[model samples]
Target chain A: MGRKLLLEHINVPGINTLEVYRKTGGYRAVEKAIKTMSTDEVVEEVKKSGLRGRGGAGFPTGMKWSFLAKPEGVARYLVCNADESEPGTFKDRYLMTNIPHALIEGMIVSSYALGANTSYIYVRGEMMPQIRILEKAIAEAKAAGFLGKNILGSGYDLELYVQPGGGAYICGEETALLESLEGKRGNPRIKPPFPAIAGLYGCPTVVNNVESIAAVVPIINDGGEEYAKIGIGRSTGTKLISASGNINKPGVYEIELGVSVEDFIYSEEYCGGIANGKRLKAVVAGGSSVPILPANLILNLVNGDKRLMSYESLSEGGFTTGTMLGSGGFVVLDEDQCIVRNTWNFSRFYHHESCGQCSPCREGTGWMEKVLHRLENGHGKMSDMDLLVDVSKKIEGNTICPLGDAAAWPVASAIRHFRDEFEWHVRNPTLAVKENFGLAHYADPLPELVS
Target chain B: MLKVEETQSVEFSTELVNKFAEIVSRYPEGKEKSALLPILHEVQAVNGWLSSVAMDKVAAYLNIAPIEVYEVASFYSMYFLRPQGKFVLEVCRTGPCCLVGAEKIIDYIGEKLGVKEGEVTADGLFSYRGVECLAACGFAPVLQIGPEYTFYENLTTNSVDQLISDLKDKASKS
Candidate 1:
């Protein structure tokens, strides 16, 4: 009920300081876990809470921690995946910037659960400011005996470090992140070894996202089961959705999981409705990686649809009538927005971001990008629309990582829901709108520096 | 092919050493490698791009393999393996920026500098590159120099010439 349940005392200016955070009960979770609760107890508490990973994967946090192979004298690690590279997803950035201590505290408790004496927060390099905040927070935690030797006199020593990524979207994948952590190329590795079994210098490691760790602090502070009771079956607790794009007020909203799709969009409480008094055309319920839902299906609750925002509900029909709440990156598009153009934009990002390690993803992403480019820029044929769909199919599951899926899903989904628009663009061979409203906005060019 | 530290002929000062140590202390025990990025960053702060000598000092201080450091250095677009010009011009070439003619601006700079996208000029005044989204969407056409971001709201031939002249002026003053 209190804001501190997630972002408590965060807004009190200067509260980021250790002295202020201490006054607001910041490291209380770490202290209580180390001093009182056993490592298994902490894990059990988290498991009972029904807390799931907020890092798009939706894996159970306790189950992930429980998976670490505890070999004798072998080093185990807890890696906080702060890479936050998902587009329209900046919740982790907001959390790390405003509440660094929350993550730091959570990491300490989670590390203790997994017998990890050392933890690393792998932040994206582009987040230069957040990196500074984490470094400062770690220093404060170390100074307060919340980290380093015998934390809180419990003899359960742990250390934390921050590693910035080298600007590759693929590195956001756990194994690739581990590879990057090892100072190697940031390319995804085959699963089954899955970070938990072999990761971070080939040691047993658990890589949780920033929001996932932040959620852990609350689970530890409140009994895990108590936290789990807040949301619906299987989808427990609150999720932080970074809502942007054609929304009246685009910011991060902490919604109780399983809230209805309609309520999330139209409710005065959530996004405050669409921007510019425009009609909602469609929704990319998750991050850009998920399929788009048509406005009719997304808003239709009468025909046994029950468009709720949960793992089970959104994915009930498997893209037939519903989508996912992935990473809670809800990007709402208004009627004025062009689905074809937006999909093309995402296609280019995936093509540029593909690590070139997998043949299908490497080539398919480029082909899709080119097709989308031709479609968006008015050089496309009707066959190009089908070609985009066909290319997405080729790349979906043929890659080492889900990045291929992340690239293919949006284009595939947009085409599925808005094929007419893609066809319209090809048939017209001109910009969709006579006014070129968004294009005029794009007329001005960035400055040229001889450098 | 040459290592970063091996290329730096100058010896680092005690002040720089202390700065590097402070960055190293940010991480906890047996996690010294976590400080690799920041350490390289600090080294670059001292000597423009990561020279072989600076990288060597970083690897030695953190007890990491030099190739480990090199892998990270080369992988990131921001980290330069070779020395750049006085000013590093990073233009955003992603969707929002690209939609607004980022490519034209990059081409303009390439032509003016008499070099390609990644090359520095003979005079060492400028080095230009096209980067991903800089998160300045309000200013669709955005370029960053050091920490300063300048948005081209209404770019034209005149504005392009002015930007180049401005860079020359700023380079001379520095």
Candidate 2:
């Protein structure tokens, strides 16, 4: 059903190779933009397309591009953030591994628009296989004249390299990524001189997420207005939702924006409902960093309006009642899952990845993890619930990078929505260790568990 | 306990040297320090782990201080501070994976290997550790063996034993 834009030819045979990709209208976007469109035209087209950044922030892409400082005799850069380390988000890995050329093609067009002669795709180091896949595709593109000097004889030149991050999720933050790109510790830099003004080696830079960059090909092919018309309102173009956890079909699905949340989870064409006929309890609509919503809030607004999967709709009530479409990492949880245990697990992840840069983030994340660990293991106090919220609130918006807030949102929201479940853990410590708190009020009119 | 002092001159093969040169060239002139991450990858691939010698050699090659190489290498989780076994089983233990029995998967690897997590077997054939999300949660209970870059998905306790045996077989052959 829905119109597929980014992943139209995803399953085509040999699409991974440059030859097959080129046959299926792969590099045409490059040719059209380079030979026909001016650099300003390309930038203006993206602005008109209403394309927002897919890297979780949802900032306008064209505005981010236009911010690049074009200082005289200075170089600018386009670094693709391929560090797909956000838990439950594998779309970037899926894209780069299966259809590498689309990213390569998009990189060429985007590099031209930013007037950057060199670009780097900073992929997480764990995806070594993906790095190899991209390296092969880049070499293939270079030999075909899509890369290197005077590409397609349009007088624009670009060189793209696939750099590996040494396994730190903080590096996914653009400034931290640039620091790691320069072979330093992955501590994030402060603002004012945003990456657009002073980045990598003190040169102006534009670091876009992998999907954001790859989506450029489709926008150029369809024209800005045409591309903008596909998705509902400001959530223009298609988005790759990587669905996992308690879903019958857990994989990446490229859905046109504005698909209803209920349809995406219940329809056979998408997630095909919860696995094993289990009742849905909670779902992290975005990645692990975003707030987790119980089934009631995820499916409907407070005013009983049916919720759709768009930037505006998902975040309707802000952090209190709604969550983000962050990174499109749709993780679903069924009735049998324990919110306390799950929150504890994510708290530990944030603690492990704190980067030790800021006092609040470095200290607060660790304290949250330790306290949550106590609560999950049945040693929690009734006061520990409030302590968790207090610690989470302190870390949010206090660090140089969003990782601190990313750590805080899940814990804070879980306690906000599921205070009863957390309270039960403290009350029934022995039973909590032996069994999960179960669905409770997570799913309204809860269906009986199948098994 | 972690090795840092060098004992001998560290050298790269001609092919590796050429690859390093190509990587360095990607950065601007005098910005060769940016090649530190990839060069460390190359060194680890060649020498098994980054000994003080290899790191100092990377530092000398980049014209940066050796401390620059050490601090950067230690901050990242991928670089082995010690020489791990031939097969490093990095199990994804984040929320999604844990929801699908990742805790049991990791526990099984540790029990079967007869070593604690992060400790190599005496034979140096395998090492196991619980790592954070590898972003492949759709196939939950996943593990990656590096620097071979192979992923084992949907793992059970029995499959883990079979995996360890298969890796042992391959390790003996190579």
Indicate which candidate wins on lDDT. 2
Candidate 1 global lDDT = 0.75
Candidate 1 lDDT, A1-451, residue by residue in tens: 3133676565788766788877887787887888889999999998898888888888888898888888898889999998886766768877887878888888998899889997889987767777789989999989888899988888888888888776777778999898877666788898887777888878899999888888878888878878988878999888887876666666677888878887888777778898788777777777778888767666553244557778878786676556777888777777666777778777877888788889999999889988887777888888887787888888888888999989888888887767777777877775553322222111121111000
The whole-model C-alpha lDDT of candidate 2 against the native structure comes to 0.90
Distance from true location, Cα of A46 in model 2, Å = 0.5
Error of 1 at A302 (Å): 8.1
Model 2 spans with C-alpha error above 4 angstroms: A445-451, B1-9
Model 1 chain B lowest lDDT segment of ten = B146-155
Clashing pairs in 2: none
The DockQ value obtained for model 1 is 0.26
Per-residue lDDT value at A368 in model 1 = 90
Task: List where candidate 1 sits over 4 angstroms from the true fold.
Answer: A1-4, A301-306, A432-451, B1-36, B47-71, B81-130, B133-174
